[model samples]
Target: MEFNFGWEMLLLFFAAAALAGFIDSIAGGGGLIGIPVLLLSGLPPINALATNKVQGMAGSFTASMTMIKKGVVDFNKIWFAAFMSFIGATLGTICVHYIDVSVLDILVPIVLIMIGLYFLLVPNIGDVEKKPRMQEKLFNTTVVPGIGFYDGIFGPGTGSFFSLSNIALRGQQIITATGNAKVFNFASNIAAVVVFVVSGKVVWLVGGVMIIGQILGAYLGSLMVIKNGSKLIRPLVVVMCFLMVARYLYGKF
Candidate 1:
């Protein structure tokens, strides 16, 4: 198929990428924005999804670097999780062609609503240090692969999922969770994007431009989150989760 994107679509792509990157870097629902924007821009369903993956990877990569420099993450410890995430993502990407995630679309909103409410009402939920129930090795081996599989299957709130799981289940601090989540997210994205690219499902020209916006926006978001600390990131996460819930509901029914 011949590829073509007009000026209006180009503008929207950049705008969506910037906004999604900002939201994603801070709270992790950027796909909810970027994906729909691509769909509305007139790309086919598969192409839109693939294009979004391409652009989204740029944002994830940028945030991962920024958080690493800030000492918010320890890659050496999370390497196992990251590797598992890649495998999960590859599996998910392969399944995307065969399975429809319509049921997951219905479930995401309900899950997000609960998550959003928790963040909104509970202060210091993720700020405090706590003991983990599972050993690090076990959690990394099990939970990371589990979440990565889900991410590949239905990827709306992967970042938030990772963050909350790490804190609630593994007893990591919020900043650390978010930072570690980005690494896993990047791994997942890399796997998915490769599948899309190999299948010729991306609009490289448009995706390339969108990636520029995503990179800049991600950098800004990382800076903002770092400056404000968990206090600011918490509320944004709540709002974005709620938005994801609404969007998922709208898409499903």
Candidate 2:
């Protein structure tokens, strides 16, 4: 594939990146918008995914920083999870380079739809403050690591999956859950970006522009979530889930 980014394409992608960054930081549907725009921009699938991760790193970093500053995360406890997520992401990237993403494309949407359906069916799910079902160490070590691996592998609905799992299985408050999710998502993206850069898959100029848009949008999304509450997050998650379903279905046909 010829690697050239026209100004018009750059501008259009920047807009999409901003929207994806904002929506993804808040509700985890950024890839739904970002990846499609990238594919439409005339890049191959792998290149698009690689470049998207580069931009996503920026958004995740900004959101993670904001959430940390706001005291929405437990840094000490989450550091281990972050490390594991990075490792998992690196492994995922290598696997993607070698394997086919089509199978994952089919599986991911099923998982996302199930998660979204659960959220939709349960009344006041995020509102309830409940104790964790699993022990903290076990959940962090086993549950979080497993999710991190999936995130590294597939790269969609990661934030929502992390948040929902934290809330449902770990029984964390919504704010803290989102904050920690950002931290891990940052790690996952960093790992993917490292792989992409090493493999020469990313278009730095294009990725850089997308990163700028992602940063601004992520900042705004963090602000909005802090101002609003789980009430806002729930609906957005549903929408993102629907979008994921659509993306997967389109890919199949």
Candidate 3:
């Protein structure tokens, strides 16, 4: 399909990317906004998904770096998780090139909805740090890699999953978990973007335009996370997760 790179279209998409980056920087599920905006702009589904990765990588990188500079994330502790996430995402992206994603269409939304409900119903779930129930190594190997693989293959609610895992299993404070989530999200996004770039699926013009907005939005959102802490992030995470569920279920039925 052919697309017109008009100023009007660019502005619309840039606005959408900015909003997506803001929400994604805090709690994930940015694709719920970005991909739909791309589709509405007349791109084919595959192209929309591929192009979304470019802007997503920009947003995640911006947020991750912002958190790092703010001293919210400790790279020494998270480097292993980040590396595992990158590897998992790479493998998942390769699998996507060969396999149908329809199966995940049903499964992923269910999981996201469940996660949303968990956060919504549980009181003070991530407000403060608690004693970890699982070993850090186990978390890096299992939860981190598994979520990274899911992010690469499915590409939504990854931030929520990462934050929830850190809070529930690793006993991290909500703000700290959100910071760490960005790191993993950035890793997975880079892996997916590389695959999309190699496959010639990215629309560089559109992606490049949206990336400017993504960077700005991500920086602002990261600041919000630092300022508002869990009070802001928790509700956003729950909302984003449910929004992802609705988006996917609508696509399915």
Most accurate candidate by TM-score: 3
Q: After superposition, how far is residue 153 of candidate 1 from its true place, in Å?
A: 1.4
Instruction: Write model 2 residue lDDT over 59-89, tens digit each, in one string.
Output: 9999999888887776887898888877777
Query: How well does each candidate superpose onto the true structure, as a TM-score?
Result: 0.93, 0.92, 0.95
Ranking by lDDT: 3, 1, 2
By TM-score, the candidates rank as: 3, 1, 2
Q: Which candidate, 1 or 2, would have the higher lDDT against the true structure?
A: 1
Clashes per candidate (backbone, < 3 Å): 1, 0, 0
Cα lDDT of model 1 by residue, 115-220, tens digit: 7888788779878779997888888777888778888887888898888888788887777878888888999888878878898998988898899999989989
lDDT of 2: 0.82
What is the C-alpha lDDT profile of model 3 across 1-253, one tens digit per residue? 4567889999988999999899999888888889989998888888998999899899999999999999999988899999999988988877877888888877888889889998889999878889998999999998888888887787777888899899989999999999999999899788888878988888888999899989999999999999999889888888988888887778768
Candidate 1 local Cα displacement, residue 80, angstroms: 1.4
| Position 45, candidate 3: lDDT | 87
Model 3 TM-score on a 0 to 1 scale: 0.95
Question: In candidate 3, where is summed lDDT lowest over 10 consecutive residues?
Answer: 1-10
**TM-score preference between candidates 2 and 3, better one:** 3
lDDT of 3 at 50: 91
